[model samples]
Each structure stands twice: as C-alpha cells, then as structure tokens.
Target chain A: MESMEADILIVGGGAAGFACALEAAERGATVLVLEKQPETGGSSAMSGGCLAFAGTEMQREQGIEDSAELLANDLKQLGGTDADPALIAAFATHQLETYDWLKAHGQVFSPALEASSGQSVPRVHTVDPADMVRLLAARCRTTGKVTLLVETAARRLQHDPAAHRVTGVLAEGRDGPIDIRARNGVVLASGGFSRNPDLVRQFAPDCEHAVFVGGAGNVGDGLRMAWALGADLRDMAQIKGTFGKHPTDELNNHSCLCVYKGAIAVNQDGRRFVDESLSYKLLGAACLRQPYGAAFQILDEPILRSGDNEVRILDFERRLEEGLFIQADTLEGLARQIEVPEEMLTKTVADYNAYVDSGEDREFGRKHLVHNHGALRRIETAPFYAYPSTAAVYGTYCGLRVDPAMHVIDVFGERIEGLLAAGEVVGGFHGNAYMTGSALGKALVFGRIAARTALGAAAG
Target chain B: MQVVVLLAGVVDPKWRLDRLGLRPGTELADESGLPRRLSPFDEAALETALKLRDADPAVRVTAVLPGDVGSDALLRGVAAFRPDRAFRFDTSGLAPWDPRAAVRLLGLAVGAACGCPDLVLMGREFGDCDDGVLPAALAEAQGWRFCGLAHAVAIADGRFVAHRIRGPREELLRLPPPALVSITNDRGNRLRHPLMKNVMLAKRGPVEVVTPQAGAIPRAVVARSLAVVPPPQRGAGACRILSGPVDAQVAELAAYLRARRQAAAP
Candidate 1:
C-alpha cells in the first residue's frame, strides 16, 4: 500500500529494460525500472552476446560487405512470412545507431567477428552481455534520474479507461504491494516465456521436451499482462529451440556445437540426419523428429584441434575435459560411448569421410562448415569424439503484437493507449526463423524506440 | 545467536580460461571481466548459516564479502539470499600472502558489523591456495574453536553438531559455540533458489565497504608475478587410427587402451 511515481515505468531490467531506462534518462525523464530478479540482467546475461548490426566499422575492417537492406532481407528470409516487415525494416535501419549508442555508453565490443546461426556475413558483433548490462545498470544508477528497483516485479498495469491511458503499475517489493504511477507510459521489456512450463506446453508443446535454459525469471509475465489488455499475438507457433545445448550439462548451460566446426550430427540410428550447415533452429527441428529425439555431434582429433576453446560453438577441448565428450580411438568405440549402434555409426562416419575427401556430400550436401563458410574436414583422427547435443527452448520468439514505434497493438490494430512495450515480449519482429543476433538486438532497438516515442509524445 | 558468514565467489569453473590474463605490473589476476558465481563450498557455508537461522529465530546471520567493485554483481546476487547485513572488506591493494593484514582487516570488519559472532562460517578453500589458509589462521587469531570439512552443521542443545565425512565413516562432532567451521561442498547443503522478490530487493540494499589504509603497506610475502596458464593438457598426442572391419577396429582400440593403461601403471 506504499506508492511511488516516475514519468516512465520500465518492467524488467534485462538489456531492453536497461536500454529503455538509459534512453528515458538521457531525455531527462524520471524513469523507474522494476526488475523481477534479484540481479538485473535477465536472459540478456545468459545470451551469446552477439548483436545483429549492419554496416559497422567492425564489418568493414573484416572486408565483409554488408548493408541494412541485405540484413533486412536476410532477416525476412529467415524469419519467414510471419515476421512484420515494418519491424524488420526498423531493426535494419536503426541497428547501426543503436550499436554506436551502446559503445558511446561504455559498452565495449570486441573487434573480432563471428558467424552465428543465420548470419550471412560475420555481422554478429560481440559484447560481453553481462558486462554490458552491468555497465548500463551502473550508468543508470549514477544518473540519479533512473531508479532501478530490483526485486520489484510488476503484477498488473493500471489502465484508466476514462483517460484512455495506462496510469501506472502495481508491483510486489520488500515492503509489500506498492503502486507506481507512470506519468508518461509503462514500457514492458520483461522478456519472453521460455521458462514457463505450462505456457510452453500450451504455446510450443512440440518443443516442451527440450530443456528450458532461459533466464530463470522469464516466465511470460509480460505476455499474460498484455493478453489481459486484449493485445494481439503473433508467431505463437514459431516456438522453436537452439540446437547445441547438452542435455546432461547441469553445471554450465553452454553447448559446444562442434557440428559447426565440421562435425556431423547423427540420430539414435547412428545415421547422419539434416545438413549440419542449416540454422541450429532448423537442426533442432530435425533433431526433435528423430527417434527418442536424440542427436550427437560426432567429430575427430583434427576438428577438435580446430576448436577455439573460448567460443561455445567451437570449444571441443573444454567439453572433452568436462567429460561431456566421449573420445575413443575408433568410430565404433565412440558410438558405444554415446549408446548408438556401433556398426551403423561406423558406416555413417566412413560415408561422411568419403564425402569430405571427394568434396561431395550425397546425403546432406553440406560442403561448408556453417552457413557458406569454412571448408569441411574429415573426421578420421585416432581419437574420435562424440558430444551429445539436444535442442532447448532458449527464448520464446512469439508474444504480444507491437507496431514499429514499439506500441502494443490490439487485435483490431489499435494501439493500447498509454501501453508501450519492448524486448522479447513484443513479437512480429522474428518470423519463423531467428537470426543469430536479432533477439537481443530487437530488445535494444525497440526498447529505445519505445522510450523515445513515449517521451516525444509527452513533449508534444 | 549472531553468526558471521564469509562468502567469496570464484570465476565460473565452466568458463574458458583464455579470458584470465596477467594485470601487467600488478600481482592481482585480471578478474574484472569474467563472470563469477557462488562457489560450491561458499554455497555450502551459506546454507549452513541459513539452516542455523531457520532452526532458531533468535539467530542473526551477516555475510562479509572481501573484494573490490569487481565483485558488486556477485555481492548483489548474494544479497538475494536475504542476509541480515553484508559488508565488503576491501582487499584491493593488499598482497596475496599478507594474512596478517588480511586477518586484521577481516577481524575489524566483523567487529564493525556485529561484535563477536557465535559462529564464523566459510568455505574450506578461499578460492586461491594461499588465501585458503586465512580461515584456519583467522580462527586462531580470533581465539575461536576451529573445525574443518563440516559438510553439514546443525544446532543441538545450543552446540554445533557437525557432520564430517572421514574416509567412508561419518563423524558427528559436537563442538561448542563460537567456532569457525570450514564447510565442504555437500548435496545436503546446496543453497536453495532464492525468491525473485528477494533477488530484486537485495540490489537496492546498501553494501557496507571498508577500505584498508591507503599507504603502501609492507607484506610478509611479495609476489614476483602470476602466470595464468591453461591446465596441462591430458592425454595429448595423435589419435591412433585403427582401420579395417568394425569388429577389428573395436578390438584393436580396446587392446590399445588396455595396453596403454597397463604400461602407465605404477
């Protein structure tokens, strides 16, 4: 029954929420960010730290030609038809500016470029997501205008029907239930619903079997609140997963996808399945269809040597040390460790080796390591390794529908007046497929837009 | 009963070590950039504190973290566990081997927070080898009873009943109060998942930080430097390719592994 007030109230303190807080603070607005978790960073901290940007200096230095147009096209192609063209266009145009803003705000990006799941070029600019968030949170606190109330979870929005506005939000904190009035509007950047089992079973039942490795606090609180207000939804059926997660990995939630480093993925039958060059999401889809929904990334010593132990997708040796990898002197021995039929696995490796030698993959035609990059290598080393890989639902790609301006839109295509949203909670940004950096990118790009649009309207 | 809990987080063991580097002229490890988490042993000790608090409502627990601002995130994460009070005993300028100065600072911090705790709980190893010696030495310095390898500790008749696993047998030592016990990681003492509410509220809470004297202090030991090397590679060599039929290849690999194991046996 306590109360507080701010011009703009932000729900969730992940990348998107923090970005909004920083933006609103820059505009001289008194903003309050309510984070559900004790710590600020949500899934953003656990993310791969790659942001999708176009025409950056990093890209230029790497001699990789890229444009917003090409980037948007790739997003559209990957996201499928369900993706909102306007939102994709918005991400394309403003991504470079957001990148600059982040850098200008003490966020450091390593110049090294990496090619992730769906990136055409090495456009995935890397930043330590946790560090970036910590820096942002520190900056917000120092500003004095932005009050980040951690452990404060918003329960419901206060929508004034008479004024046709969202006045504030009611949240639970240390004291008890407290109401916070937002003079401008309320922005929901609370992220996705990947961690909610009931919600996952309802929306993405097919992928429910996959491990839930999302941020512990991401339970679709934003989606539920939006639904209560009649907000329309999009791409709900597009709840898929990323493929490198090890099912047995409890200590570390990372997956070493040696497959991208030219390892072949095999099913329980010990036969190669899909073309390993496809997007991990697509690979995950193929994996779910296999018997017992089991798959493994089988590799050899040469491929293992090529693994850059630092990178999750390439850390073959680390996984080997963790005993997550089964190394044997022969293919049959490797197969026995992973519990697959020895004979079938041996034949599969032999065929794959032949394919690599001839540079011709008759089954999957996977000539490249990942997405038209890197040459294929034969897995014929003395100690063959098999890393058990399972697809896990990381982030829910579908949720409340929103316009390019970051305003939550209802079923009738009308903006839920006074209700603005950002981050993974607002959908229609990603279509059917996900680009490597777009999830976090969308959160940043849209979070800023939401704040600017709300503040601009207030000034008007 | 008042309890002082000492907590220190280690760099996530699961993370690649390439991020660890020398801090140029400084003897300190460049830990500013890596992700840190509550070490298993730290969790065990914290769980011990919580269990003590839960068992007796009169028990008050305070957490003391010793580090620089680099540990703020970890400090906030620790706060979510709802410790009554948490203090960061700044160890920024102190040398690694200066247990004399370090213990003095810790004793001062503990006194400043809550005078003379009934129990002082900490992990057996304080992250690094040299620093791990502090807990045992601190117990002697404070003139408190010291116990080690207490996987679980419980209050029985106002005394500490510690479960220490010795070989295959379990020893139940009933130690008097005002003891310093170094907890080892045990499944029974895994820290429970803190509620999201407490997790949020802890960040806004104040962390009492105490700075040691700014003047350059003499140390019992001076570090020449530190070498951040990858752990020695295990079973390094070329893979021996066994060709021919599947059965022949399997038999050959099995025999090779057996022969290698026998040859290396002491």
Candidate 2:
C-alpha cells in the first residue's frame, strides 16, 4: 500500500499522455506519467508516423494555402454526415500548433505532402512517430518535474464526491498496489478500446469481428475508468478498420504482403464485391459488408515476380513458409483449404479472368486497367497464394464526451471536475471514420488543451 | 574469426511452467513480478552470433553475463548455445545508472575481457527499459560505429553490412571495423532453439566467474526500482469464420484492401 503524489497524474504514456506530461511540466507543474506497457510509445510507436496538419510553418513556407476552416470542412465532409462540428473545429484550429510543437521538438518531417484518407488536399506530413515519442520521452526525462512510471497500469480513479473532484488514481505496478494522489487533476491519455472485444462489440458491433494489428496493450482501460466515473460516451459506432490479409499466426509481427499489386480479392461466394480501385479504408468497410467480414487475396506467379522481387516477393515467401499465408495450386484447391466453396471459387476466377481480358471491371469500375492478360492466367499456377483477409481493428473512435476545452463531461453534460481526457479516449473527434494523421494530430492538440485546462482549474 | 556476443540475461515475466503451474526458483521475474522466459531479443542476438559463427569455423562465439551469482542459471541457459567461452562478471553493489553509464561500464568491462573483439552484438532494447539507446551509447563510449534495429547482417570485405529498418524504409549500411550492432526481431529473421547436444555440452563446459575489481562501485545509482505488474488477462473473442459465395467475398475484400491502402499511403 505505497503511495505517491504529484501535481498532475497523466495516465497512458502513448503520444497523448507524453504530450500532456510535456506541456504540464514545461508550464512548471509537477507531473507523473504511468504507462501500462514496458515501452512508452504504445501503439504510436508501431504506426506509419504520418502527421496531418494544415497551414504548418513548413506548409506555409512552401506556399501551401490552407486554413483551419478548410481543414475542418474537409474532415467533416470526409467523416460523412455524422461528424461533430465542434470537435472538428477544435481539432482544425489546434492542429497547426501541434505540428509546430513537434517541429520545435526536433521531429524531422518530410517536405513532401501526400494524400491521406478523407483529405482533399495533400496535407499529410510524414515523420517517424516513434522518433517523435522518443524525443518527447527524452524531454520529459530532462524536465525534472516530470516522473515516468512505466509498467504501471492505472486501474481506477479516486474522486471526492462532495467536491466532485478526481483527487487521485489506483494503480498496480511491479511492486504492488500504489495510490497516486494528484493535487491538480488527472488526465486519461490512454488509447482506444480496440483490443477489448466486449467494448468493441458494444461500440462497433459491425467491426467486432476485425482482427487487431496494433499493440496487445490496448484493452480500453481509459474508457472503462471514465465510464466508471460517469463520463458521457459518444460516437460508439465508429472504428478505424484495417483491410489486409493478416495471418493469424503472425499477428504480433508487421509482416504484411501487398496483395493489391498482383492479386484479386474474392469473398466466400467466389465473387468480387467492391471496387478494388477504392481506398483501403473503404475496402475495409466493404469487407464488413460480408458474412464474417473476411475475404481472401489470390495471387499468381507473374504478379509475385513483378516489382522489387527480392524486397516484396521474398518477404511474402518468408511469411508463406512461416504459415502466415495459405497457398494452393488451383482455384478450387485454394478455396477448399480456406473452407470456401470450391465450385463458386472456380467460377468467380473465370469471371474475373474474362473481365481482365476485356480490360474493364464493370461491377466495381477499377481504373488501373493495365492489360495484364498474363495476370489472368487461370488460377492453375503452382503455389497459388490465398491470404485470408480479415478486418483488423486498429482503434475505436468511441470515447468520453468532451467540450472544446477537452474536459470530460458526464452523461448529463456536466463537466467532470478535475478530470480531463485526450487522444482516442475522447469521442467525437473522428466521427464515423478516421483519417490517417488525425489520431496523432488530435492527441497533440487536445493533450495541450487538457493540460492547460487542468492548470487553470488547479490555479482556481 | 570469433564472434563474441555480450548476452545480458533479463528476466522474462511472461513464461510460466505449465506442467508445474508455477515457476522455477531460478527463473528471472519480469516487470510484472511473474516468472518469465529469457529476453526474446537477447536470444535473437545469440542466434545471430551463432549463425555467424557456424557460417565459418574460424568464427568463434563467446557469451558474457554481468550480474550476481544468482544469474548463473540464466548464464547457463545462454551458454547452452555452444559459445566458445562464457564469463560471468560480479555485478554486486553496482548502482543502476542510465543506459549511458551502463554502456560505459559494460564497454570497458567487455574491452578488458575480450581485448576489443571484431564486432559487438546485443539486443536493440531490453524489455525492462526498452529505451533502445544502450547499444548506440556503448558504441559511442568506445568510439565505434553503431547501428540500431538491424534486421539482417552480412559480413563482406571484413566489414559488417547491416539491413536496418529506419522509419518507413529499410536501409543497407556498411560499418567498418570495431562496430557495435543492436539487433531487433524484425518480421523475417527467426531465432533457432539450441539442440540437445549443444545443451549437454554447455552443461559440461566451464563458466568463468570473475569477481569485482578492487574499489569497484558504479558511478550511477538507481533512484528507485519499481516492479511492473501485469494487467488483467483479456478474454479473446470467439473466432468467427467467414463463409459464403466466393465472387461476393472477393468483391468485398477488394474494396476493403483498396480503401485501407489509400488510408495508409503517404
């Protein structure tokens, strides 16, 4: 029953928690960060590290004309009709500052802007997100005011019912149970509930069948804590769905074989369902339209030999040997192995071959009409690969309801005193669908906001 | 051409003896305070060292363990890999400093023990701290070229060529003499387990135990050492097998793949 004390207790040492700790410590407050995992990066470290921001110093210097309004509108449109206007506005306004802060922290960014999911403009900025976390960690270590407790999981929040203030947290570390008392406030920067099947089923039932591609540590601890404290939840139906033929055996490894280049995906009924030319996110959603949200990517020998054969082909072959991929010599045989209907699979490939001969995908309107008549070689090629594609849930968009100031609110819309949330733990930021750089951007922006708001409340 | 691997034994808190339903007394505890297996990354390092040594008879492999006598079992486990030599240094009363201090001390000790070997290989990051800065720090302390997260390594022209995952892309870099490498378990590289013969040989081999030097004390001190507790076990959902018409499924998968690629693309 050891006890520790800090001015602010930030839970989850991912991008958001670290960002909040950095801001609070830099503002002259004693902060303590608790990470459930041994590493501080969380899923942020394993990500592609793309940061989306409009009108950044880099972008502005390059004469890329953009504004918060434009970005906000784009996000809202991209998220469809269900997006929250207030959250979008807040995220857009603060996104530039997030980018600027990262740049100031020595995060190297590529000057080249690329397109991301749901963005009309090429506003996606790429950087090593792990490096960014490392930089923040290094800074946090030097801050002197910030104490990091890794391999510590915050289980519950201690609240003063009379004052309606969250005074501390209950956590378990290597030693044992620890009571962390926070004088200022508590910030929950823990990530989404993708790994929690129950929560996923409750929130995103359509995507409950998706496989997880990220860390094993994302079990919705933050969301559960907030829910226990009567935090109002929103956008419970949203998810960041990943569409890839992820091998169940190599779930922990990042060994993804790009089947898009040379293979055609088929459903259980042996037919193409959606336009293969659409984005991967849309394709992931389309997979959910199937029976179990699963499909298989079929590839031939010629497609495997194409491109950087050593880099791409050998990597896939290695995975195949590791039993991460399912291979068969014939279309019927491949379907039988994965339990798909053999007769239907044969007919489906024949139809796809016919379409390939005509250089047209009438049903889905695929645009990459490179007449690879050779690619249409009957699925009779030896060692035909069939990677079962499943929905891998990266993160849930559902989280605690928050105001523009990033303060968590109760079900009745009353702000929870001394309790704040940021990152994927806060809802309405992403709406129905997620954009690529939005997670990192939202973490940085709302993390700073939560710290500032907590500081203000503490001062009062 | 002997490859000397500095195998530091770390406690694996995840591995439990299934038959006994308990852990052996000699097992090292992980941050969760549970009996765990050996560090997977360190095992990978040992595997790489052994592979390099086996590739050429001239290459000899040695293992080093820096801890108290309590770490003998762990050292024995590493020695089972049939290293040319194994040494256990006295780690008593040493203050746990930052990686910089640990690397400095270990580099000096290793230099003295092996007289500056051709190349030094270790895990990119230990599970305990996982800062991934130790090997680089050690290399910097010894004024040697260093590479982190090396997925593949090949020796050419008496220099080590390493393929590393740097950010998004993989880079092939060549380091000249006296290089230090921190190996990361990437997707392709797999570590092999020791055979029965190697294990028996390791059991019979002599493990040289060295006491601490006179007036030896670590320059750094651990402010506090905290145990890491394992989180509650999560319930895995039932596997839902997708079954239906093949054409419809392919159509559905294609759309999903395209959208995901579009989302992930730079």
For every candidate in turn, the CA RMSD to the true structure comes to: 22.0, 19.1
Best by TM-score: 1
Model 2 chain B weakest 10-residue run by lDDT: B21-30
For model 2 the local lDDT of residue A51 reads 71
DockQ (0 to 1) for model 2: 0.02
- TM-score, chain A, candidate 1: 0.95
Q: Model 1, A361: alpha-carbon shift in Å?
A: 3.2
At residue A431, what lDDT does model 2 achieve? 73
Tens-place lDDT digits, model 2, residues A81-148: 66778888888888888888888888888766644455555566877777788788888878899888
Q: After superposition, how far is residue A117 of candidate 2 from its true place, in Å?
A: 3.1
| DockQ (model 1, Cα) | 0.01
Candidate 2 Cα misplacement greater than 4 A, ranges: A56-70, A110-113, A204-208, A249-264, A276-282, A288-292, A297-362, A365-388, B1-266
Candidate 2 TM-score over all chains jointly: 0.55
Model 2, chain B only, scores a TM-score of 0.72
